[model samples]
Target: MRFIARFCKEKSEYFEIITIYDEHNEKEEISKEHPSIKTITIKNPAGIWFERKMHDDFGIIFEDAFDNRPLVHQERFPKDIHPLRKEFTQTKIEETPYLPYKYEEIDGDGVFQVAVGPIHAGIIEPGHFQFSQAGENMLHLEVRHFYTHKGIEKMLEGKRLEDAKPIVERISGNESIAYQICYRDIYLQATKQELPLSLQKRHALLLEIERTIHHLTDVGFIPNDAGFGSALSFASKLGEEARRKMKEVTGHRFGFGAVSFENSFIDIVAFNEWLNDLDKDIDFFEDWIMDIPSLWDRFDTTGILSLKQAVKYASVGVVARASGVKIDRRENPFYLKHGFSMANEESGDVGARFKVRLKELKNSIEMMRHFLEEDETVLEVAEICDGEYQSFCESSIGELFMSIDIKDGVIERFFARDPSFMNWQAVHIMMQKDIIADFPLINKSCDLSYAGNDL
Candidate 1:
């Protein structure tokens, strides 16, 4: 919060924190010694329940912006609230009652619906979408998420920033760096401390490596989903091979280093060496994917999302670029302000996104090759500041926005908005015009990580 507080504005003038938690059923006012902070509680809907209970008082609490206050709608904090609440035992909130059987009725000659996911024979998590269709065309689609909502945001409340790294990383395992990149910037804003100059370069380099790997994994999946699985096999192997070398470099499989505060860590030369090998593997994979005409034929004109909707929904990175919206963080010229050109395609289809990711992977290889050849002094930090600041970055997926509030060198407030949340809606939009059989195919092509959205 401190980082967010400081970064948002002057920490003293504009600091706000709001929180809500379920407790006992009593609607009692808690202590508010800090006049600046406001606390609101409806009631904690938990513990000794009445013989019969209705779901009237159960809902989410809205946070007040001026002061960090928690407003609870429930009459009591449910024992089911935070699984980690100290006084009450923890249990999965999933057991709580929910209305799931609602159905809409219609009288028509030949209306049909296709219920997809929540369980499919794919290496993907669960999601269910009921699409009311008329033969090959779709009338409406209702998406049923929460299949992977682990309440991670709620879990991070009141916890220290360092402790939240693992949680953030786990929020979406595949896009670990996007989360960590936002997480690190927010942490710095909260603490008002800059890391060593060498470390910042190291972070950027490592992040690019992660970006390369993530793109490979997902891009490879597109072909696999299209039954052009061979395009992905070698690419997936190279990606995994890249990860293994990165693990040897950072001592962690996913490149999660001393994240929050500085701590003693592992090798650097090894990272440089592995980066070179990664380039070769990527080149090999790229060549293999290109030779397969089946993949391109299926993907080329499929799932068209135009530029207007892409920006309207704030789509990020390759997804937006594939649709002809050219916005890349490296070109922002704010922080680091490196001279990098954006890779764009006006095709607005699965193939466009594929080409964009492929170009980005190439860019990563070039960027790393340049950085690795630099001397130790070249990447060294000459400037570090002590102040709160807001950081907005574009991830491989989309815009990664974060605010850090720092006070007394500790995080006071931290907030993050990932690109997946913004781009997730676009999937539904693009899928609308696509064929019934092409629905799953379109979704897999624009595979916006639902785990990223759940946060």
Candidate 2:
């Protein structure tokens, strides 16, 4: 069983610990009076973060857990102040005395520590990366995030289904379409409404557009990190064109409000012309990058994540696919009908990841073309029944899982496990034995989202 997510929901007399796997789900009821349960991390290491987050939110103890350290709460946060508890209704709280965080330490004769960011020089989100190194070679890397946690899950409680769409769509700016589609799928499931085939095709097209934009950005940034600025210039040009086309088609550059029950119209002539130009430009870009031996010297075999480690960590998206794991969620008939093909690589290194993104970019372009060739029409909303519903989407990053509980026509509980949440855990594994200088390149290859993960 592949572990997916573990979360907790507060109840009047007890707390429910929900563990979700690929095939099945397990629930454990812990009395609120004594909210302690046995840890599953001994068997499934991926549960480490989940259990710790639950402890921070609901004060549910996972007894004998391998790592019981706080995952969400940082230093100076009050102890025993469970934010997600039903009784804790304050919107503001007082900070406690300074408390030092315990990061894993490595002591050796020449080993020294390098700490980077919770604040960075670039216009990016905050995340701390601590490195134990000996003369530029990284011995260990520990990543600490969640500095921008917005309490989104807690904010969703008691919100009407329609009112939650904007909030969910904005969870990650780059993944707006994916989140919207996933949320719409959950709503459809709860309301027992089947989206028209026409609308589904439109949604798929918008999704592919979003994927292409992000992949193009990554491919460009990867080369830029290697000191190849021309590739970034070319890629930025293409990405801007794609973003403009997105706005033309969906009335939003990021496709924020694109996935809905209403119909969306597209001009086939202009859209097809843009796609054709993009396809040719991408081909040229890929060939140009591949022929640059200097770039390959920096990319090839740098920051390797072995297949064994990938599976052990349950890595997803490009991280898993580049390591030869066939784990994409877009294998359904709809995608296949639209000429979808999974890209794979066995090297598990920077070059392999770059190539995978190139191939996926081409595949997404083709898929969008196929989807646009088909006819589409409008859809209508269905009556929503109050209950639980779950949905998944193959977002640009990887599989995005969302689950929600509806009670009295409003959201009672909402949980989302973004691809970044899974992929970020495996980055430290990739950094092992790599040089500190190449950290920027390897990290750009992964291109994780802090907002999505922090939420």
Point to the candidate with the largest lDDT: 2
Per-model TM against the reference: 0.72, 0.98
**Which 10 consecutive residues of model 2 have the lowest summed lDDT?**
373-382
In candidate 1 the C-alpha lDDT for residue 434 amounts to 64
Model 2: how far residue 273 lies from native, Å: 0.5
Reference-based lDDT, each prediction:
0.57, 0.89
How would you encode candidate 1's per-residue C-alpha lDDT over 151-269 as one tens digit per residue?
45446644555666777766676667667777777665554556765555556666777777788887778887788766677778878877885676457778664233333343557
In candidate 2, how many Å is residue 142 off?
A: 0.6
Q: List candidate 2 segments past 4 Å from native.
A: 373-376
lDDT of 1: 0.57
Point to the candidate with the largest TM-score: 2
Residue 385 lDDT (model 1): 37
Error of 1 at 60 (Å): 7.9
